[model samples]
Target: MRGWRNALMLSLLPVLVSGGLSAAGGPDYPITPVPFTKVRASDGFWAPRLETNRKVTLPANFQKCAETGRISNFAKAAGKMEGKHEGIFFNDSDVFKVAEGAAYTLALSPDPELDAYLDNLIALFAGAQEEDGYLYTARTIDPSRPAPGAGKERWADIKNAHELYNMGHMIEAAVAHHQATGKRQFLDVAVKCADLIDRVFGPGKKYAATGHPELELALAKLYRCTGEKRYLDLAKFFVDQRGNAEHRELYGLYYQDHEPFLQQREAVGHAVRAGYFYSGAADVAALTGNPAYIDAIDRIWENAVTRRMYLTGGIGSKREGEAFGADYELPNATAYCETCAAIANAFWNHRMFLLHGDAKYMDVFERTVYNGYLAGVSLEGDTFFYPNPLSSDGIFPFNHGEPKRSPWFGCSCCPTNVVRFFPSLPGCAYATEKDRIYVGLYFGGTAEVALDGGAVIIAQETRYPWDGAVRLTVTPEHAGEFELRLRIPGWAQGSPVPGDLYTYADPSPAVITL
Candidate 1:
């Protein structure tokens, strides 16, 4: 068995090395993710849901995007179809999220038909892009139809246009496509769009920040993927200019622009926007070693997790603006724990874990993944919940049509986010900190971890979140000293988290590892 494992590890080394597990300029953290393709989940809790996402959820979403005029809007913008913009200005992002989800699914399970479909969609995007690489279908399709509550001129309404947000998703989807397929067809388009954005919004140009805080993270990802310093600079610029009015007019506290990011410590404003901004700041800190970004993110994270979080790992207590309430203001029945907010929280927590390699962050990530985030989608993968309240009254109507999971929503960001997130989960299982590999989550899978010595295959088997007995078999190609660190979840040690916000009424029996 040992010889066979060694052979298997040797055979997979080339593939793992070529997959680009480490980020450009090396990750600032000690840990880095093992690529998704190298870790294959077995028959376990997440396997079925991952399968359903690939077979049922994504295809249905693609069809829905086609039927709902999202695809045709692109065609119309390209002059291939004649129709007005069908949905909101940000509707273009939904399509990109679906594409990203499909790319993640393809990384695990390749399908020729799905690949062909994505190729066709990329062609549509290519057609829709303007001469200088701008690609907002709502504005490109008909410049006469102004964005809701905004002007017709480009960049006129930075607070509501969502143009930057749309491009952010597009860049993310393009990078995912490139990573999954090793094809640059879509990546080239994203590069052009990003270049145009860089040219338009900088020191001497029309200095501006996105109303929605997603482009910073996207630019960070693009920079990491392409090793381009300008993208990283742009990302840092966005973070630095958050509260500076010279960049753009402040949209008030509701938009998280009341104070500079480094000065603000509480998690405020729209829940999703706040989470994305923090996550982007975390990324910038990782890349640039900016002490201000790191300090702000740590303080903000502590505030959110300790004072503003629910027992179910949910956030955003108020329904009025879908925003976070004051400290200890968590309401159970009327809690507005938007699904996207929970997802964003998970994203931020994961970045925190990457930055610090702390078990507390993984505990939060695991808790949110198993609870609030999973609650966003139905078991059958067809319906979704937009706001997942901790306790429901069975009468208080929530946003997105119904209190229960619904087939779709007028604003379908949550569902598409669910689609994009669930399939990329395997990448979070393990991280390599030089020669030492850390096991973060215990899913039954095989991870090919790249280390300074060589490739190590860690085969994990367990019934986690149900049973706590995990057996990890480590096989290295050549015998070289390396450490395997296993995270002991806070729950198993008789605490909910490393904070005073919540605690178990009684401690359960501690996990006994023989």
Candidate 2:
């Protein structure tokens, strides 16, 4: 009977191809095109409503928290710096010092309202910036601002003061805002900052190495958004600078400054930092098509997905380092699935999928989004989860009974991150390549795609995961042969047999002979 089934399957192949498979196509399903003007203006699984709402609300809440001097109180209580290096909150602003988390949030959203807030915040930081673009509130000046005291006189704080992370986040915000809004104010801020970063960190530059690994990716992304070769070179400089020993390296900071990214064999340091660097590496790989860079990414992915990952697809081994632990060392009790780390993981996975066109990467993305990320917000979308744990009983005392969502946190990275990422979901569902359009993920929406022949409106309608049924309808303006490739999720393999049918909108479903 099995032999007969195989023989019958082989025989039906020709007929099936000749018949021209009927697929669901139309404009009902849509995707937010890349280089958007407003975050969450379009909707889909890549971004959902609940998430977008959070993104839009966070900065305002933080600003309110800042203006009322409530933020200062929180900073003092949490041991974070409440002084003048202050612009926006960076995680636990008191304990972690005036750093970059909030600035990073600005990159993710860049909406007009948010942009204005960021402008004010940037002005605050600008007063703190060292004539050049070097800005780190924690290490550069005392708490009061305008020369009460110098920041981090020991050189330890500024050298390791998350200066680069702040700039990187600002760069990201600038690029995203420019793409979404067609405005240059944010981009101009980023460019000025980038020029400062180049002067300070590029070849023969003076800033030493980045204590945090973000600006590299941000520079790469900026390059992609604009056709600026200088941005690309700056990004390359950052990537090449990693892991080098000869540099005026800062010790006992985050990661070792003894080598470069290509030289580093394993993942290390803060989970978010490691993940961000890996993401930057993937961007370089996609842009340059460098096999060595791709090889590094493959190794990093193997290390991350196979060993350092949680069941929820979250990465990081210990709360102590917020870093990588050994293989299979994933413990549920102390799992520090930092909300920012999970968000970074999603960023890496998205870029990897785009670079390789692999569905498995998307699978990881789905896992991270549904489990690791969903835990970041409350059901009402008002609260946030910082350390997403697998089990939250008495054993996991730290995160137990913590509010699902809150108006704010001592370290406010997660809240703002959740808000901005939610609105950008639709842009991730599909990508176009000349004449061939790839349907990466299924979500109900419409996309206007410019193909080789002409523009075609693709409408997709489906309630995925909730239901297996999917329908896609394509309406073309002119007659052309356009290939629409659908994704066959790996999980669908070895499923039960079912009767499925798909229909198309165009009459006279044309037939062709090869």
Candidate 3:
């Protein structure tokens, strides 16, 4: 197994290493995110996490996958090992997510050893794929013993099988790896997998959407990667197919299937699902400039920040389905702020900002970073808190029905999420428009921002989050007039946020400005 991958990497290293495919043009939104590669975050808060994720978290996540049987499942399915699939069916997603994190780490700083490791894993993944690009190990390992929800027939239960969900993560991981390493080895496998999915489901095909709302984002990424129209169409199909009971029963709101996605206004059902769904909708909106899609997510985002979100920017109050409860359903002692939900919230808000160039979106993103999402992982980066409850009494089992922080979980999404998220901090620090650049989040860093005006270098020094003072130094390639927008935190501006969902009071007066 190892020898073949070692040979594979050597064979392809010379031929396929052109940075990556240029993004295909579309009706893209006005705001463009400055890639993390362009921003160098040197802050005490964020820089350490980036370094720690590379040095500790990424390797630890892969180690946990080895221990928990996630990596082995791929081996077993590839016929390189002798064993039944291990852990939950969704376990494959953990490995894919970890791989995605590793790709991000490699982008920051290349590690040949880590790169080779991913090559081996991708070989296992490639071997496990069937002739037609069917790649779920739970079913591929032994069809007769498919995971409980994975019905005997492939995709028999689209609502619970998580077949597409697993593929979504894999595709995203592959795109990240291809972009980071300039290797087409992993990208080939991902293209096969996505192509198979595209053939299996679509307008005239199955017309069914996955229970989980993830493939929406993956297909969008794939579309941008390869400049393929089918992937984009398939992504739109899934978004449009939900709640359409013309051919099958809806999975209901628990899966964001209660009504056609465009018709839905208020955020409802599962929080993580809703978060991913909202982000995917934004992607489609940005790509096609579909007014209905844009208007829909606008209302949905309003509902999320105004009614459903926690003060910490964590979302989903109900533990029953790991979902959002009614408006103002928050209960401090019983809060179920799943770490994955917070990560999804950050992802969604970032996409929202890209869609509208609104500072409010990053305001929420910053809050989640500092509070809800930050609490998910410990400072050392090994232990994890699955839930972010406001207060813990020590007896209520507040943290996802476990202690506040555990080294690992059976459903290891949170830890793996932390691995992928913190490495992306530099991406959140800056964005660009035609003749202007925007500072989305304040971090002491130097960014080489490429804009329509020209290449500009912005340097900043600040304690920010820890202290309020910030100073910036900007230099343009040539003397020119351009706009620079700095996002002012709602709290600092005295509004806290747009709606009356939160407030602040103090006896002592302090002056603040945007």
Q: Candidate 1, residues 404-491: lDDT per residue as tens digits? A: 7887787889988999998888888888755557688888878898877889898988898798888888888878877676777888
How well does model 1 score by local distance difference test?
0.84
* lDDT for each residue of candidate 2 in 152-251, tens digit (9 for 90 to 100): 3422343445656767876776666556446666576677778876665567655455667777788886776666667777877767766655655544
Report the C-alpha displacement of residue 160, candidate 2, in angstroms.
2.4
> After superposition, which runs of candidate 2 have C-alpha atoms over 4 Å from their true positions?
1-56, 63-131, 137-159, 250-259, 394-397, 400-405, 494-514
TM-score of each: 0.94, 0.75, 0.94
Location of the lowest summed lDDT over 10 successive residues in candidate 3: 1-10
Instruction: Summarize candidate 3's per-residue lDDT along 9-29 as a digit string, tens digits.
Output: 211221111111226766665
Q: Could you tell me the TM-score of candidate 3?
A: 0.94
Q: Model 2 Cα displacement at 351 (Å)? A: 1.1
lDDT of each: 0.84, 0.58, 0.83
Runs of candidate 3 exceeding 4 Å displacement: 1-22, 506-510
